[model samples]
Target: MARRILQASFVRRAALSAGWLAGLHTLAGCAPTLPVVVAPINCPVSAEQLARRCQAPQAIANGATYGEVLQLHQLDRKALRDCAAHDRLLAEMIVQCQRTILDYNDRLVEINRRIADKP
Candidate 1:
């Protein structure tokens, strides 16, 4: 009877450990994979210029009046339209920079929403 109890306990512990490991394996498989981003090479534009242009929209988004927002949108549209006529690589960079600015604006909107939600 003593030997049987010991063997049963060992079996139970083994099964528990196997279940735990299987759960971990399932979770590892479900984990999201990170995206890989590559930077452009041999570009004509300087990083400083890109950074400055990118920040332009964010500055407006941060503290612009309704009229300023309208003006900024017009300016952004004109700039992107002009960029579309340039070299393909430069146009792509301009579009990417515009996307970054829009994304920043989206985050700022979300932050404002959260702040307004707070008591």
Candidate 2:
């Protein structure tokens, strides 16, 4: 009788967990989806704006922002050798362009706050 009771309790707990997992999946499925689109173009400097406009093709030329780049600063020796053969300036420009975007966003937020305070 004791063994029977233990088995019943285990089955009940397992069923509860299964039901909870199903509910989580249903909730996740209800989330709104984002569209896959090209990145925005709004650089403060026209040179940087042109660079932003040309980023995709430049990235392809540099071949530096691939799956391997996600490994952080630890690049494979062979890959680094290959990248050195390509246009290093392209990668540098991309990094600078991204930094400019972050700075621009910060300045815009500050300017909007000042404008809002007037009225």
lDDT of 2 at 97: 76
Q: What is the alpha-carbon lDDT of model 1 when measured against the actual structure?
A: 0.68
> Residue 74 CA error for candidate 2 (Å)?
42
What would the per-residue lDDT of candidate 2 be over residues 1-119, giving only the tens digit for each residue?
A: 99999999999999999999999999998765433433555533345434432212112235666664655334444456555644455566677879978876776777666656653
Clashes of 2: 0
lDDT of 1 by residue, 25-87 (tens): 999987654333323334346776455432233246676789988888888877776555544
Off by over 4 Å in 1: 1-86
Clash-forming residue pairs, model 1: none
- Pick the TM-score winner: 2
